[model samples]
Target: MTGPTYRIEVALTAARQLRKLDHPARRRIQAAVELLASDPRPPGAKKLVGGEGEWRVRTGDYRIVYEIHDHVLRVLVLAVGHRRNVYRRSSGVARKART
Candidate 1:
């Protein structure tokens, strides 16, 4: 069973941004959030800070970024993005943005 999933305050903010979009885009965002909640694991180049770890999900032009730490969770909605840029060196911007 996929116990209760927690959308941390930060992740909630990111998800909120998606909620403001049109139906199709909003559904896309919802899908990505669900994907993250189900298995929020960072991929190959997922950025790493002192925090636990970070990962990215894409929905059209937006980037869904998040970090999973020891006892904390954070997420951000990044503009001017794509999956490629999501996993690039630019992840530092995302790390700082979360803080």
Candidate 2:
């Protein structure tokens, strides 16, 4: 409630990735996603390295990769996966970044 609510949009790649997770993990991720709508940079969220406006939220072993578009007041989720390999692969959101 600190700022304007951000519209959360999950990319197809991210949605697909989310669908692959187990039930409990999916629930946690869903809760995290809801939080992002209210606070794009919620507590415990981290800015991902090598990208402007890119951030990550952790839920157990899973990671939610997202980008904040300030002007548009939107949050686009780029990827969703486990900690071990989430950063290793290029997500749709990551690919869209200039740097």
Candidate 3:
């Protein structure tokens, strides 16, 4: 346990709907999520301008969304749809920039 157990919320309503995916896809999503939750702000979890200072990363077909402060992590998953359309939306385009 670290940082008092970070909070994770799917930013888009559609993202919340991912709870029903089959095992394989579900595992990938889970992996990205756990990384954000447990590690030091992952390699791609960069900061976007708005959307509540949220961050994002990619894992194959899915995007890992998150927010990081001094000591806490908040993951706001925007989409689990598809590769192309995932980033087509503004929120997707606004993900934390990569260095």
Candidate 4:
């Protein structure tokens, strides 16, 4: 018995970052993103501190930063990149989304 799924919206920045990834990494990350539609907080996902409702999931060395809007039932992907820089970049991306 699956529940209603959330709509996934990839921000332009995140989309661009995803496009720059290598083939296998891209595929794996895409799969993980899609899964959020059904389970936005899947196993291993973590709610980021000071992220203003943001959550993150990992796929290998890469990380996908996103936010779940329950009222709208949407999953907004804010950024995607290597673990080292994704967090730093996502905060800026998320700020842009607000304005």
Candidate 5:
């Protein structure tokens, strides 16, 4: 049987980051984000160290950082960017989410 899907919420900064990407990368990332609704912890998704309940999934050279709220059945997309900078940005985003 199918399970309930989680709601997906993208932070403003992450949305902006996604918009800055090329069409192909943007599409791939978008697809990955959508998949989180049904499977928040898909294969290769990893829990980020030092982050407050944060998780990440890879898509090409980019990464999608998010947090899964099981109680509310929601997935918050904290940041989306190149592997180099995504984690740095996500740490700040995760902090902001707590406030």
Candidate 6:
């Protein structure tokens, strides 16, 4: 039997963004997010320098930005977007405005 896995929590903005994506893109990102539940630091996952505990993974031209909380065993997905635009904005800027 499998042991416990980190829970995946998607931000509202990230969920909206995911919903707007094409079917293939959505599937790819969904798979990546699910993988984070089992392996928060999976191969090629990079820890973003400015945000402590925040990590990122890639799927094609898309990027998944998330943070791992060991205490709660959760993976919070903060953002997802194209490589060229994902890192351009501050994470907190749009969260409150839309949520």
Query: How many steric overlaps are in each model, in order?
Result: 0, 0, 2, 0, 0, 0
Writing each residue's lDDT as its tens digit, candidate 2 over 1-99 gives 266889999988889988999999999999999899988987888776567668888888888888889899999998898887776663433322132
lDDT of 4: 0.86
Q: Name model 4 segments beyond 4 Å from true.
A: 92-99
Off by over 4 Å in 2: 91-99
Lowest summed lDDT over 10 consecutive residues: which window, candidate 5? 90-99
What is the C-alpha lDDT profile of model 5 across 1-99, one tens digit per residue?
988899999989899999999999999999999999999999888887667788888898899999899999999998998888886776554332222
Q: TM-scores of the models, in the given order? A: 0.48, 0.85, 0.59, 0.90, 0.90, 0.85
Q: Which stretches of candidate 1 lie over 4 Å from their true place?
A: 1-12, 42-45, 48-53, 70-99
Candidate 3 ranges with C-alpha deviation above 4 Å: 1-4, 11-14, 17-22, 49-52, 69-73, 89-99
> What is candidate 2's CA lDDT for residue 80?
90
Candidate 4 residue 38 C-alpha distance from true site, Å: 0.5
Tens digits of per-residue lDDT, candidate 3, 62-81, equal 66555565444455555564
Colliding pairs, model 4: none
Query: In model 1, how many backbone clashes occur?
Result: 0
lDDT of each: 0.51, 0.81, 0.59, 0.86, 0.86, 0.79
Candidate 3 lands at a TM-score of 0.59
Error of 6 at 59 (Å): 0.5
Q: Please give, for residues 1-99, the per-residue lDDT of candidate 4 as tens digits.
A: 998799999999899999999999999999999999999989888877655888888899998999999999999999999988897777553322221
Candidate 5 C-alpha error for residue 49, in Å: 0.5
RMSD, one per candidate, in order: 6.3, 3.8, 3.8, 4.6, 4.4, 5.9
TM-score winner between candidates 1 and 6:
6
Q: Model 3's lDDT to the true fold?
A: 0.59
Which pairs clash inside model 2? none
Where does candidate 1 clash, by residue pair?
none
What local lDDT score does residue 88 receive in model 4, on the 0 to 100 scale?
Answer: 76
